[model samples]
Target: MVIPDLGRSPRPAPPHVGPRPEPGSFRDPANRVFHAGDDVLRALDRTAAADWRALAASSFFPPLLTAGKVCGTEELPAGSPLRELPTAPASSGWATVLRHERVPFVSHPYEWSFAMLRDAALLHLEILRAALPAGFTTKDGSAYNLQWRGTEPVFIDIGSFTPLRDGEPWAGYRQFCQTLLYPLMLGAHLGLAFQPWLRAQVDGIEPEQMGPLFRGTRRLLPGVLTHVHLHGSVQRRSAATSTADVRAQLRDAGYTRELAVATVRGLEKLVRRLDHQPAATHWVDYQHTCGYSGDDRASKERFVLAALSAAGRRRLVLDLGANDGRYARLAARHADYVVAVEQDPAVVDRLYRSLRGEGERHVLPLVMDLADPSPGGGWRGIERASFAARADADTVLALALVHHLAIGRNVPLPEVVACLAGLTAPGGRLVVEFVHPDDPMAARLLANKPDGIFPDYRRDAFETLLAEHGTVEDRLELPSGTRTLYRVALP
Candidate 1:
């Protein structure tokens, strides 16, 4: 199949079109991304254009793009109207423009669960393996290059693919270890969460930082000996050596393409075998243990469905603190896309696996703490957007979440209401549940806090704050009289 090309337009180019340059896309000089309204366009220099030509012609490209492993791409013929955008790199004139299929939402590795990151790593390796036989390979291994289409991972940076060179080691090997392999190993072997580390260091965990974590017998784990222990030792020894010198040495030592292929194969096998079975957390089995009777549970579900129906069809839905994605699955029936944000990694992992197994493609599960969500990070803190910046859901389901933030996290009721209001799109609806202070669950949350510290944690206070924030469209108290649900519409 040939790549689709939009021929040059007969009409004149738009005057002073201002396409916003992606702040995170500046690292690569050969190709850069720009957003012109709804279109996601990539500007390719002469060299990158050549690479794109090779990629478009490759036999593997069509199949991967068809299978959704790679982003759907089409070339804009030379002199196309989009080429004249103001944000196009003027220093080096672009030879061609390519448009990519936009993902529903952009999420970072730090916000992903263990399974999500592992799957992304496997997809990266799969792409490398597929490209090797066709004389092409990825130039970089960054977790950022991968984005999710619900439960599926798609490689977005088509510019990373290039014709392979003879006797050159895998350029992305160290990067693969740093970003993908080490993070997975940290979770699988140590049962430690890698999200915070990744959030702290966008470049990912280095071998030096990871090696010392494994002590004594732990160093003998499947990939630890070579990838972590010895790799760190080598990096420490070569700290002063120039990268050019290392490449020259490897070339002189006869490191062949076959070696790179073998490395890719080995990494794939190792990654596939790695698994993290986290110890049971409080929220992992919340659906079964949430203390809701049959009637109460059914009533809650009916209320949520009614709220969703009242809102009509939604472009996007947010399920904050989605315990096991029960309501996220429900919201999916009424929305184009649903983002299920849960703080517990294990719970999110289970949700992701179940969605992947069932071939569900509408609900995207994410591991994020509502108390401390993802922030603006990377170069100048604008390269990667904050969670609040990315979230603008038309329908937000904040079920069984307010108590956690207020009583558990100590966030005031007004602040919680304001935060939820900020997440709702203009003229959108928020379905939030407020657990009464006398409820068993709320009592458990308040058990450790000093007595009378949260006297204002009353239903009246919450409703007053909600009224101040938006119009209360509907309200329902559960049969148990322990929880109240409100469907508020933002002005």
Candidate 2:
């Protein structure tokens, strides 16, 4: 189960290497990552060799590891970060160990909301604050490096740390501006979603582009004028020159550590000052307005709680199409962590807002279209992970979700059941809803499609599909109508 975590490089490895370790570990020389069963094996190369040893010895990494914010560094064979790491003869060099976590889940900046992006920004700044005292600085400041462990943002790329050079400008300052600063400011001031802009500008928002985007808001804030407005104008004027003496001008204009820190603090304050007004959209309004009697809602909650009780609360839960996180919060009450997946952009944004409050550390909201989810893209299209690859949950909830896929999207019943089953971790529970064709919601979905594409869209057929994957531990029909809840689990 070895997996390569390269961001977006398309180059194939040449066969000039000594003994190939694992396929996943061969992506970079800086850190040769392997797996010895469930443990992560890191082979430090020249870039990470010295720092790896020193960082491991330091007190900083340990607290983060204990907090589940970063992976723990274990004692491998006494070796230099410059040397090649050992691997089993059967290893393939990229990833060759039978580890529990094959790779990190793919999270794009465009999918994140303002609060999520802000938290990631703060996490990176905190990392900078922590690592700076340890004589290291981050070489990269992309939002992609931040991942959510529940509601908390964690920095996973330890290899991004490099030896700090004094008297030089912050290497990642420009990246910080593009990745975090501009996006936050745009969302706060212009009420932009930031995802579309972020997706189009994968590297980061170019200063030239920022000029036009913020054309209407030139007088909003002093910091925006200093950083984005004026900076963008200067970049536009200097477009033809490659060897422009911009750094000296910036230095003369007082871009010192104190100024940089103050500017960042201002950005932080601005991110917090954002008032995320819930934009009006179909799913955002419809999820609350449509289809469910008071009794039905209560019955669904009872069914979910019962399932959660039977499943145990020590593990993680994945709620597919978790619109606005109504049920996800319920799952969060019982489980250690809950990942709420919703395709509707508006609903996900709203849910992200609810999960951002302080002390809420059990929910993670993701934007994904279940029918055509995010595919592995980037150089050679091998850097990112697909939806199915990231579905490892202790339990899965598919409440009111199947009908949309089964009839609206025309997915087969067996495939729908199998997809829900795929999200379950070992000994995990699957709580799903099966709405008969006669059900109001199911009828509405059927109306969208041609006559009789889903002939097997019956409750019995759904149960049969469940039987093939796991035993149906419990079943209940809501007092409202033909909608039913089933608790299925692998034996």
* TM-score winner: 1
Q: Report lDDT (CA) for all predictions.
A: 0.87, 0.68
- Provide the global lDDT of candidate 2 against the true structure: 0.68
Give per-residue lDDT, candidate 2, residue 248. 62
Query: Candidate 1 residues 1-491, lDDT tens each?
Result: 23322221112224434887888899888889998776788988889999998888999888998888888799987667877654343565778889888787789998888889999999999999899888998889999999988899989999999998766667788888888899999999998999999999878888879877998999889899989988888888888998778878888998877777898899999999999977788788898887899988999999999999886778789999988888999998888788999999989999999999988877899999999999999899988999999898888899989998999999988899999999998889999999999999999999989999898899999999999989998999999999999999999
List clash counts for every candidate, in order.
Answer: 0, 14
Model 2, runs deviating above 4 Å = 1-29, 52-108, 129-136, 196-205, 208-211, 216-256, 280-288, 311-314, 356-358, 412-414, 425-427, 447-456
Residues 252-303 of candidate 2: C-alpha lDDT, one tens digit per residue:
6765555555555665666566545546677887666668888988988998
For candidate 1, the TM-score is: 0.94
TM-score of each: 0.94, 0.76
